[model samples]
Target: MKIVTWNINGIRTFKSGIKKILDSFEADIICVQETKVTRDLLEESTAIVDGYNSYFSFSRGRSGYSGVATYCKDRATPFLAEEGLTGLLITHEEAVGCYGDQLEFSSEELLALDNEGRAVITQHHFTGADAPQTLSVINVYCPRADPDKPERKQYKLQFYKLLQSRAEAILRSGSHVIVLGDVNTSHRPIDHCDPEDVDNFEDNPARKWLDHFLSGALENGDTEDQFGNISQKSASGGKFVDSFRHFHPKRSDAFTCWSTMTGARQTNYGTRIDYIFSNRFLVENVFSGVDIMPEVEGSDHCPVWAQLSCTLLPSPKFPPLCTRHMPEFIGRQLKLSGFFVKVSEKQNILKGYKESLPGSQEAGEIRENMNPVVQGNNIIKKRPADKEAETKAHKAKKSKLTKTETKPQNNLLAFFKPKQTQLNPPSPELNPDPGSESSACLTNAILADDTHCNSTQTKSSDVALDTCVSVVTETKNQDKQDKETAPVEMCRKGPCSSFWKEVLRGPPQPPLCKSHNEPCVLRTVKKAGPNLGRQFFVCARPQGHASNPQARCNFFTWVDKGK
Candidate 1:
């Protein structure tokens, strides 16, 4: 199994094109840092790669900032995936839950450390001759400490301490751990291109921490002072081994990151801040080789991969989080057209619209045709003569009904009228007030063109007729009002469903998509173009191949094109 790690800078830079580049890498598991996207801004192409199962962690405090993602091939998918070093961020039931003794840091501290969306942990089983062994891969994008910000320096150091605690906790939980990503700190002068120019480089706090964090096999190159005394190290030994340096310790200028603004990468003037650290036992036994791919050119930091000799054990009990099985991607793999296309009434037996048509076959006849009985020699078919005879009989019956139907409208109205006994004429003295509500209702119903009374009723006085007509008028008006006020059912199935609901409520809705008739989702332009930071709208459906039934259509419209 080949496991690769890279800080892609900004994942949305690829957007819909990321999938093709991901497929080109051909790694079993690829962990990317600096995704710079929130959960809301996630695109279909990035979330649901064709053959990979992905887990993502987004910054809760910021948008288009620090984030990380892990993509595992379908065959190499993990049984469990968790986000953040803190136990607070473990969303999945299957997790590396043994977060032993973090009494040093308060609950608020733990939450603050993980709020930047830095880490994603995935657990897999690696099988060999013996019983299957479990391994945890913690992918992290460590915080970069700015020299100007003293508080940031403390935060970065705290992150490292929290990270170390989590790794040790996982180790104690019986799972071998592989911690990898951009450490953002060069451990020694050999790892940095221009280490000699910097004053007091060895005194850097992060480098000092790395010296003690890595296994004792790597030498701590402490310079001798003028008094000929060696500086004492912080710790005697460390828990993890740097995989790349383990294989090529003496190899010079083996940098993994560069400054894009200075074009330092062109001159090979950079530092090796990215790493893949594993247990010494795994480095010796399971990992066959570890190397960097400097040729790949999407980000300033290139990818570092390790080849493992062990096979990835599959777990049916806990299936991997593949796009096919995930709630957001399932059924949404189709294009927008697939959802809006009209379905035929004949498709449902309960509708029976086709069977109700004149000269159409009855329900039993249609069922008989569906399952035909075979004769000895000749195949059975509905005779043309019999069909013509049935059509003629249908026409004759229709004509006879038409002749008998003297008052078809009254007959239909009578079905809705309640049965009532004949009433005697109202007394002359018992007269209703013309200005009362019931009197007004009676007047309106009698004057209305659609109102009618049965011939069986006596030629009653106006007062008696007024009571009967008022009840019918109110019932009809109530039914009419209900039909007019009922809300239309909106599409409620998709990743963007909740977003669309909120978008639809307040402002005027965006123009409906031509293909799906769905209100397009709003987006902003962040790339280097003429329309940078410009807002626009596109289909809200999940992205997929054009052939897919639920994939979004190519509907593009700028929110303010003139601007």
Candidate 2:
């Protein structure tokens, strides 16, 4: 699969440029950095391409700022850091409030902390290849424009440490991992077009950190020269051996980025800050790597691409899929209608029983029996109870159901228990408040799962590595329980099902101002510009209305309350 990495600067402004690159280059996986758009903004924005899954990790910036996004034609699965590693430190005041307490320190302190943009990794699964390949691709936009600042340099060092730890973990798992992005550093003097200017050359902190990482050295200049002087180092690494590097041995100078603001490519004034590095074992044969320096108008950075070929391996086998089954004891009780009817009528039935029957063997048995059933699929079967059994149950119960005959019968169970339906038809006047009781039952079911649910599928290999089945099963069970107990609204004499249904069917109108009790809307008036005649919403209420409109009421929602 062809994996490409590029720092698209601000994704919103450079989206068209990015689309052009993707359309022409045909990359299987693309790792992007400096997206500078929030998840909410991205959701509102439309992508120009199809057949690609995109993942974005955005910084908390109102306007354009530091951010990153990843796109892949293959199946892209988001892998968050175990302890919330996918976040950026606030550099300004507005960002401080956006993240709130999520940041460890104050805005000032965080500014003193790391200022490099966020780092995000997205794993892609490729099936067509011989082996089941899982590629961990990372995008990083390190700090820039503060070449003289010591604090900024320290931040870059810390960033490299964090990145190296993450990369090592992936490499240890025997997975093919690729780390790429704009490192904002030129490894050698040859990496820059003007190699003769030493006075203008500031120290390359990004290159220094990367060199330490690759050489496993603790300090700068700690390792001996493996590839001769800096000039020769650049020459050996710079060239396209053939059109693609793996095909030929001759070196050709290729640069990835150019200075657009100064028209510097004419004077050959550009630095090689962008790079792609793979695990040593994974780079058996490097086909080609090149920096595309086209005249892109919107962004300062250019897109980079790499192509490689490797020996295919057989797909690894995982353990057989285990089927989850509900416990038989609870399944029998759910089959009968009486259990549901009694529970629905007595809202505090479980609490009352627990209080009265404390330490009782029957109470313990009931708890044990319901535990697995609640955790598995949230479906509790009710066993049939005749008149004698009902009498016995009532004697054991701590609370009595008020107006027992006025309970709504279960329509779902009526099909199975046809005899019970014929013997005692449900009264037409029967009405049960399902909303409150159902919510209470759902809460209890979720709590029960929290206490008793355990992964049934166990792997003999590393337990930590094989948690996919367990994680998927837990999510599935939670979804099932949530669906079963979700509120069922009573629709009016209309084609739609509920209040939300009608609201979703059309565009929502602006809500009324809470303080003034009048219609309010946020308006964006355009100033003098060529982009004229654009309409925006404002408070429709006339000036000096009955009450102060208080701008736009944040608490107010635009929904028809009558529904």
Candidate 3:
């Protein structure tokens, strides 16, 4: 039985990645964190993926917030789904704390934990190879200690403490348990990118949380070591195993989660936070291997999987339709032009969602209905690949040239240069100019006369870059002159408010920072050409954003003129 845990960030955003993983791993159960799904979507059958029996816990406080879900194989039905930790009433009071204090779950006081859909435990009774066994599979997405929200840190600590208590109680009842998901806390310095950059040891709650949770038993009966630390063993005697760390014990520079920025993943600057933990019996008997799949695209955090050495039941014949949302990969690009295709598709999906909810949870495959936008005569595919391979290849070329060299070698006029080769220029038909027949004819004539476009050609740095920029510039001019138009007011009024600041922050925001250490912002600029004097967006990144590129985020987007 293979179980996988991934903070998919938003399940709908990378529904394709989920399908890809399900196809590959054939996991018996897949647990996801930060599902960010609301009750409306869940009840509407939009989020239901057909094959596995899925159970979702949604945030009760807000519409879309922290949510956790566990999908179990059809054959291995869950015995019970404990959404609210029974007998634990949790609420925020002024004196007690924001996350609430733990008192006896007695008759007078109720156990109402935060119903923000943070954790969900699905119990399954199965006939094991040895004997009949029942496993309480708990999937938790622990709260992060966000700097903006200090109280959340306290909430996280409380959640961690409650989780341990819950695990202890479950174990005391003689039931096997496997608690796994994003703990959202780096256990040690080795688990993070740079330990020195972190807050002081005395002030860091994460370190304190780990020490208290791992060192000594929280329960009364357990013995404390000489230093009064609880061994990393859970109250139920399942030594909390960081499966990845356990296997790659001394491994460094290995991370499961990376920053959303582009170079972060490429450079492999990341932290190991997501984990799979289980009791002694489950660990020793069922544990086979742990794999961190960094290659998987869709979420900022990669999926962490563990192989349980047991026979998995045959999967269902047809998988169900996963919920559709704006692709997260779309946010990875800084270009405004990059947003058009996805933004269009997202609007369509949102419109299509108005259909009446399905009467029953019948089995059916959901073929996402995403229509592509036609720009002039150019027809682009609706769905684009992550393009990670291309990015990696480019980086690899830079790496090869920079070998054993200092930072100065990164300059184009340095000791090394990219090997020049003959290449065919882009075809004239690449820009059909569907709106203007005259524009198309003129472009074709230019291509016919130009030697570069007339035949397969090799281009010098100046000629190539200039031609590329000209093509883009001309294309925008043609688009601006076309019937498809953008709101002039939107472009003229640059982002000012906090809302606009976040909205204008381009995807894959400039990796480096501006002169004042401020992150670069995407801003609009007016173009001067033979065509319409339309405004387009560009990365207002400073020179320092990238070591080489003048603009860190070479993003471009014409203002939307059309409704």
Candidate 4:
């Protein structure tokens, strides 16, 4: 099997030269990122040659944002489908699920995931080889939070952490996995080529992109996240091998992607950010003929291809395949921008697992090793004020430390200060001023998982790590009850089939939102179908980023249907 991954930059452009491009590579399967097309256009996106089946995953909120697509030869595709929090993949035609009969997710949680269509996993049944091996092909267009925006940088970090957990789960399920896409981060300095920008990385530049943070391995001379423990490795240890590097050990200049603005491609100054990663077992199956195709044209990124020597046993029976969710995209000329979160979604998911899957070791361990800092991903940060703010905060912190260091040990005021004592532990969010916030709080506020920090203003840096961790631990103890109360079908079918009513607590309609008592308005689904015209109430002030609490609580509601 010969598979390739490329960031097409845009699907429409890629389509114009699709035939010529595919013929040049002769790949059995080609996965493209940033396809720039939404799920609504999935049926119309069948322009690829006659023998291939196309699958896509689209972004939820913004149109023409992050999107991915895969074209697999019919002969190589035994069973293909998409998977995400939607609980099931919804298509214009019908809905089909991956986890068998009962949905493994709650509707509310799945609805929350509808914002980002970054992940799409499809199963391909290969019958031509030895034993029938089920392969899970996951394609992702990871968030590229530019540094100019602090929030987006944080978002990208959170996205990577989430991706790690999801991939780990797939590996645990005993599946052959091949993950491909625009990973966005060049694994090593040599993987990238920009003399001026490259010099800035002479000293370890983990801050540029937490490479070790994403891979779960320790980068030389760095032990913690660039901003402290704002991010950590997947509990699974990120068992992915960069196939390009694995195949060509000495080819430092062999870049798979280049920058358009810098004329980097013209001079061949590029980076191998787009990748084809395989699991430890699958790495042995990849042939040595992996090629980085710089000649292909359509986007700034070129294609990376690898041949696999594994035996693919054909399946006599295939699962019922259906349309996976493909949200939105951004082609050339259109700008792509957004705030990214740094915290791990697994923290919440792990908490849920601990309660629901009682005695699950993975959940317990992840919680125990949880990092207190929350960060986001993106392009190199562009916010100068963030650095200035951090600097002023640091100076104030230094002065406070020096004063405390010289002060009498038993000063009466020491007891008066809440931080010195355990009784009045502070809530990081309560303090909004950056200069006044305690250094300990700053660390915890930025690193603490979502349960405690979400609002940009509320993400504080005053409370100590122990205080924040203790608070999180206590919150975890009560989360089984406080977690979002989603409405589930009495029968895991569709909307309720029977008219039913049960006594409910509190005012019938929600009082103004508990986050911001702001006015809320009704929003409708624009996609096609029965629910396409459905409406729900949401907060008036759109934060654009839902990773925050204001956005989370700002949008919440659903209508029940009866027989």
Candidate 5:
């Protein structure tokens, strides 16, 4: 059985179609640290892998920070699993039943340590030589001592102490313990790239604690022999063994983590803070090999793994808590499609429900009259008499529509129709007798209301009649002139009409960014500065790290100033 440990930095790193990356390791069990995922944010794709069963411990105090997960191959599922090293988070069934002594720390301190989701422990049962053995794998992402926060240094030390107590307790319970993850401290001068750069390297509390914990020695000198060489039999002496050093104790520059901001990984300048530490008995007997993989590049910390000589044994008691058991993937829940489509006997059940309700007989009768009835697989049509009656009503409606269309046109129809214009007005049609023509002219002038018809009565009657006739002729000429100019006026207004299509056309294309040759996006300044409320164009891509290829470029220009 092979087990690998890695700090994936954040579980979301697997979201970009790289979830299968875990399978590439080919290890029986894979432990990840700094998952930065809360229980609410968990996803099916992240939790479920093709051939793996996973268990996750999420931060109870925060979201998107400090979580751990373990993925074991289906065949190598653990017999027991629990969260937190303090033993407070475990259920009675899978609990390790040991937490050692906690009298040195207050209750609040113990709660604070586990609330951050720092550890996940899984016990795999295996057979060795004459008897069955249990190996407890403790995956942890230890807290870092922030220089800005002086209190974190003490917290960090306390975390390390709690971790040591838990591992020792598991050992006391007859289970071999394997503690692995980002320890957040380089134990020796050889673990760091620049030993001289760090003042009083051995004086660091975390480093001193780790040394004493591994050797069970109160003093640093007791860990090494008189010749300054580390002993090889420390694993069988009831103490933890650093797996990488157990194989290559003097290996230098074998760093697992680097500073991303300084580009230190390019020069291979880093420290070996990530480790896979196990019991000396396992390293000496059941373990075949152990090493670090610095070539892997998804995170700042690389992967370290250890292999066992024997195959893993499956648990005979309980099933693994894998993604297959999760509610989202269990395939038992109702879906939206179930409501729209008939499945199984649901349609029959619904029909029975309708029939069982009060006043359902009347509703069923109405339905039978309007809709076809289902008899076995065939649909029964409406009664013959009912069909005949329906056909007669349709024919009467069609005949009424035909009669309405064939009727004579009404005078109102002609009133709304457009009238044609004539270039020359036709002479007025009237009787040839002078008296009749005079009367016709007076009638036409009265309808036109020509101001000349309202002239003073002192003038001769013949002269007044001539004035009315002249006024009527001038009105005809005026009407013809207005009709001839109407089309020209309409054409002039057409070009200035406020069309919706024109309004929606919006602004023209913006200038392209120089870096990616992509169109820039317009943005308004929101900060309280000289350019507040001013518009500008910037690269369209989202903001990201400077080294990220998909991150936005530094192309920017004010809207008023063209680039």
Candidate 6:
């Protein structure tokens, strides 16, 4: 089984990085830190890794922040801590107040205890060659750059102590465990690039803290020695050794963390702040351990992985049946779908059809039938001398008579050839104007005032006026209809309009920051491009009573009335 530990920074943004690592290492179990994704985000974010089961613990911060996740390739049942020792639920009130005050608290009360907001443990049962084994995996991302002035050092110390205590508890559980992550500490002078930058002992705070944790003598027959010389024998009497000292016993100076600004890791100018520690008793054999340094943009940290063989046991079996009788329905369907025709072959099939068309055959037949017969155009003639001469004379006379008669007729016909006319005769309708004086007089008499005239005149005049008014009204109505039916030219207006429209159409709400009681908004600084300017948005209600600058708002709700 291969196991890997990497601090992926932000899992959503670092998915490609993690994918590349997973492809190369192919570790059975992977532990990641600094995932910076919530439980809801994790479901959508990691859907690409098809054959693996994942366990994640997100920080209490709005949505994306310090978090950890573990992935197991095998289909193993995962066991997550109800509330792990990371103090994920420990409230500030509970921590400061007496035990009695916090004794009656529910799970909600533990939220106040969350500090650095990292750490998660996932257990997977493995069937090894020997017995059914359980592997406990832990991922951690410690706090960096303390804020509190006077107690910063003390806080770091206390954090390390908590971590060590948790690690001890896991070890005592008698399960095979892999405790690996960014310890945020350099153990020796060789662990960092600039060891002389500050006072030697004071500069390496993490080293001092770890040393203090391992200082007291162990009663379990394990001993803590100086740097480059340390070994631990497990309760099962199996010896687990550190590989760094074995590979480079004389160097005394190997590092892992590097300065991103200077590309220091490439030149071996960094510290070894990350580690992968394993239990000795469970490991039957250790193959190798190495840090992967692929040339990639983003993130300063490198990934480390290990390969080992362990004695595995058989998993519990419920019942046994004939495995060979299983159905192959999906597999057969996929196999059939995989067959396809090549472009060249398809083109050939189309060409064959074109050659067999009715039009092609008809054209070919017409060309064949048009061939001229040699005998009809210029036939071979046999002749007797005397008779031939008489025959020729007779033919000449006949030809002459025919020409004489035909020539006169042809001349007459040529003389009578038709000449083209330029002007066209007018049609009968155009010859006489429809609206003449007679017609106009008749129309006027028909439409004259009716009250002083006969009965027919009265009725005709009334109908004519009514018809004219109706026509006019219809024309006005048509014009109004045309105007109302004109096409509207849609304009996007501006970036704000488009963005706000999308926000309104999408999820109706944003995540709220628990502490500030305001929405959480993600801020990003990135490289610039043409037609693209930097983006920054203040709270829509900046001066409102509930506004908080630091608070996060990942969701936005549309205010239909702009209230």
Q: Best by lDDT, which number?
A: 5
Model 4 residue 96 CA deviation in Å:
11
Tell me which of candidates 3 and 5 scores higher on TM-score.
5
How far residue 479's Cα lies from its native spot in candidate 3, in Å, is 44
Task: TM-score for candidate 6, please give it.
Answer: 0.45
Can you write out model 2's per-residue Cα lDDT over 184-260, one digit (the tens) per residue?
77655556655556643434556545555552221122223532233222232311111212221122234556665
lDDT of each: 0.75, 0.48, 0.59, 0.58, 0.76, 0.50
- Among all windows of 10 consecutive residues in model 5, the one with the lowest summed lDDT is 227-236
- Which one is best on TM-score? 5
lDDT of 3 by residue, 311-371 (tens): 5433222122112222321134467876466667766645543331221111011123344
Instruction: Specify the poorest-scoring 10-residue window by lDDT in model 4.
Output: 322-331
> Model 5, range 236-293, lDDT digits (tens) per residue?
2438878787667667889999877445676667899999888778877888888889
Evaluate residue 308 in candidate 1 and report its C-alpha lDDT on the 0 to 100 scale: 92
Which run of 10 residues does model 2 get worst, by summed lDDT?
A: 317-326
Ranking by lDDT: 5, 1, 3, 4, 6, 2
TM-scores across all candidates? Answer: 0.56, 0.43, 0.50, 0.48, 0.57, 0.45
* Candidates 5 and 6, the one with greater TM-score: 5
- Candidate 1 at 16: error in angstroms? 6.3
Tell me how far the alpha carbon of residue 101 in candidate 2 is from the true structure, in angstroms, after superposition.
24
Report backbone clashes per prediction: 7, 10, 17, 50, 1, 22
Clashes of 5: 1
Residue 116 of model 2, lDDT score: 27
Weakest 10 consecutive residues of candidate 3 by summed lDDT: 356-365
Model 1, C-alpha of 66: deviation from truth (Å): 0.7
For model 1, give the 10-residue run with minimal summed lDDT: 222-231
